[model samples]
Target: MTTNSKYNFKWEDLGDIRLGRPNLGTNTHVAVYRLMQYTMRDVLEKQLGPDKTNLFFIDAGFKAGVEFCKNILDCTLGFDDFGANLADKLLEFGIGVLRFEKADLEKMSFLLTVGEDLDCSGLPYSGVAFCDYDEGFIAGIMHQYTNLNFEVKEIDCWGTGDRTCRFAVELAKS
Candidate 1:
């Protein structure tokens, strides 16, 4: 699928991620959601590992994954590059899950977890395949979005059982 096409959205517990012409002006909210997915699948998988089964834990994982990717994207690439500019790359290349959390809705602050499964699949599961899936998604994201060429010097993660991880994004000087 093309970037425009691949740029799909799945509002978990919402629907089948169908996309129609923007009934609303910019669909910024949806755009952000798509970016979150890209972050989780691309960046987090490398740091955390891939394995997508155990849908139950995926929700929590998405939170962690998205935050981690965002900090790096924001501090290193900036919102435009990380968001709009990166959209095509993200859709085309794909990155592993980065893991993220909503630090603040008003300020749009986020945190990335360091340890523990972001997906919170809870140790011991139905085959390690699930773990691989999450990791795989993250890998895909990396393949897709690394063009920005940003290095995440350090990441601090926290939380237990689907909690937000506090994070800091260190950038590489150009």
Candidate 2:
């Protein structure tokens, strides 16, 4: 990775799970993960404005999604296969439940939904939408799979009282 690279997510950053206690392999309660994420976000929001903090979270999530896709997912698979694999991986990793609400392959536009989203499925409503990170995550995954840039935005979030998080993804304009 270059010293000035925007995203320095090397695959090796994720170490072997087998070496991590041998009994507790990537298994943690959702509350624990949320605690860390929310706390970090809180600090960031306090230091930086909400917009900047959200950008940071999105960038982090984009990096994570790219690295995760490269390391864990098979990029060679077709749309259906890739989606199925992603669904299985999300379930296996206790991330969330992924569903496709709309897909237009020709236009490269999609509406994706995640039930029990890791970001804000159960958060108390604050009228403001959360899950900017998830926007970047979904974008990263789509970029990796299609080798095309995408713009992902959260349309509905649990923070806004939605049962599921909904994202609208479209190809980036040239």
Candidate 3:
């Protein structure tokens, strides 16, 4: 909300939201966070429809992921170290636990699980996958880290009655 800058949004712009609430630093109830996300999603769906709303969310998450990688991750690490560091950082920030089921560097394909994800960890079954934003986030991080494009898709979600969110990641074909 400061002066319009020449550059895109940066992480520092998220200046400690707990500025005055030292007692509640970086700890908000999941219900409140879900309320904010779901309410905004409800409004976006009402105005833009489901498809467009999903796109908007994915776009937003993509930007966030790019910024997060630039600010928080070391992009120079090799494949194994990269994933391990990412997992550690995600856990440190309480984003989730990352478990790679498969990682084929030659094929640029990966299968992973996000346990207790912020997006849809405990949500009631909605019959559809609810991790489009997460897909974009994963793709963005991978793109920034590897300087390559990837297709990251969420195949299972808590919203789809899955205990953990499972995502399939593959290099995008040219």
Evaluate model 1: give its TM-score. 0.24
- Model 3 lDDT, residue 113, Cα: 99
Candidate 2 deviant stretches above 4 angstroms? 1-7
- Badly placed stretches (over 4 Å) of model 1 are 1-7, 10-72, 75-114, 125-129, 147-174
Candidate 2 residue lDDT tens string, 1-174 = 456758565886556767966998767788898899999999999999798999998888887788778878999998989999998988788778999999999999998899998878899988878998888888888888888999998989988888999999999887
The model with the greater lDDT, 2 or 3, is 3
Which lDDT tens digits does candidate 1 get at residues 1-174? 335755543334232333444454323444465456546666766656654323323444444335445433343654435544333433332332234443332333334433333332233333222332233333223323443322221232221223322343322246
Candidates ranked by TM-score: 3, 2, 1
TM-score, per-candidate, Cα-based: 0.24, 0.92, 0.92
Query: Whole-model Cα lDDT per candidate?
Result: 0.37, 0.87, 0.89
Worst 10 residues of 3 by lDDT: 1-10
lDDT string for model 3 (1-174, tens) is: 467666677788888778857887877787787788889999999999999999988887888889889999989899899899999998998888999999999999999999999888998998988888888899889889888998888999999999999999999987
Look at candidate 1 and tell me the lDDT of residue 2: 32
Angstrom error of the Cα, residue 111, model 2: value is 0.7
TM-score of 3: 0.92
